[model samples]
Target: MMNRLFGKPKPETNALQTLDKLNETLEMLEKKEKVLLKKAGQEVEKAKEYTRSKNKRAAIQCLKRKRLYEQQVEQLGNFQLRIHDQMIMLEGAKATTETVDALRSGASAMKAMQKATNIDDVDKTMDEINEQTENMKQIQEALSTPIGAAAEFDEDELEAELEELEGAELEEQLLQPTTVLPSVPAGRQQARPIPKRTAEEEELAALQAEMAL
Candidate 1:
C-alpha cells in the first residue's frame, strides 16, 4: 500500500545510466567553472581600470568580486573531481558484476552436463567402442588370409618333384654334342749353313765321299 501511494518508487538505475548522468553533471560543472573564471578575469580588468582612474574604493570592490568568483570556480572543480571518482568506482563495480555472472553461467552449464551424463553411461559407450574395434580387427584378419591356406601339404612329395626336375635338366645337358679343336704342327724345318772347310779338310771330305760312293 505504501509503494502504491508513492507510485512505485522508480526502478534502481543501471550502471550505464548512472555513468551518463554523472557525465552530464560533470559537463555542467565544467561550464559553470568556465563562466566563473571568465567573470574573475573581467573583474580583474575592471579593477585595473578603476586603479587607473584613481578610484581605490571601486578597485577594492572589484577585487572582492574576483575573489568570490575564483572561490566558486574552485568549488565546481571539486564537484567535477567527485563525479569522476564516482564514475570510476561504478565502472569497476559493473565489470566485477559481469565477471561474476559469467562464472555463474559456466557453473550452471557444467552442473546441467553432470546431470545429463553418468559413469554407467560412459562405461557402456566405452564397452561398445571396444567391441566394435575387436570386430573390425577380426574382419581385417579374415580378409588378409590367402584362400586354401588352411589345407595341408605333403612336404616330402614336393621335395621329390623338385629333385626330378633337376635330374631332367642335367640329362638334357649331357645329350648335347661335344666340340673338338684341330691339332697344331710340332715345328717348321730350317736350312742349316755349311761351315767353310780348309783345303786339306775339303780333300779329306772328297776322299771320304769317293770311298763312300
Candidate 2:
C-alpha cells in the first residue's frame, strides 16, 4: 500500500515554464530559418556559376543542396506555427483562470459584508448620515449669516427711532418765521391851493363897478 501511494512520479517541469522553453525554441528555429535561407541563396548563385562554366554535375549538386535547405526552412516554419498556437491557447486559459478567481473573490467579499450587516444596522447608519447632513447644513447657514449688531436690532426700537426723527422735523418747521403784509387806508382825497389877487387887480375891479353905476 505504501509503494502504491508513493510510486507516482513528480512532474519534471511546470506548465508555464515549459511554455517559456517552447517559445525560446521557436525563436531559435526562426533564427535557423534565416540562416538556411541565406545558405540557399548562396547555393543558387553557386549553381548559376557552375552552369555558366558548363560543369553540369556541380550545378546539379548545388541545386540539390538548395532544395534541402528550403525543406528545413519549411519544417522550421511549421514548428513556429505550432509554438504560436500553444502560446495563444495558454494565454487564453490563463486569462480565464484569473477572471474566475477574481469573480470568486468578489462574491466571497460581498457575502462576508452581507453577513456582517443587518437591516436594522443599515437603517441606523442611514439615520446617522441624515443627522450629520442636517448638522452640516445648519453649520453652513450659521457661517453665511451677516456679521454685526444689525441682525440683533429689535423691530420696535427701529420704529420708535423713526417716529422721534419725524417729531424733531415737525418742531423745526413750527419754529420758522411767519410774514404779514401792511394794510393801507381807503377814501381820503387832498385839496389843491387857490391864488391871491394883487392891488392893481382891486383898482381895476373898482373902476368897472363905477362905470356900471
Question: What are the C-alpha RMSDs, in order, of all predicted structures?
Answer: 17.3, 22.2
Expressed as tens digits, the lDDT of each residue in 1-213 for candidate 2 is 875987754332345776788888988998999999999999999999999999999999999999999999999999899999988887787678778878999999999999789788999999999999999999999999867987898889999999999999999999999888765556755455766778999899999999999
**Model 2, residue 62: displacement in angstroms?**
1.0
- The window of 10 residues in a row where model 1 has the poorest summed lDDT is 6-15
Q: TM-score, each model?
A: 0.56, 0.49
Q: What are the lDDT figures for the candidates, one per model?
A: 0.90, 0.89
Kindly report which residue pairs in candidate 2 clash with one another: none
Candidate 2, residue 2: how far the Cα is off, in Å: 21
Report the lDDT of model 1 for residue 108: 100
What is candidate 1's lDDT per residue for 126-196, written digit by digit as tens? 99999999999999999986658444566788899999999999999999999988665669545579888
Name the best candidate (by lDDT): 1
Model 2 / residue 50 / CA error / Å: 1.0
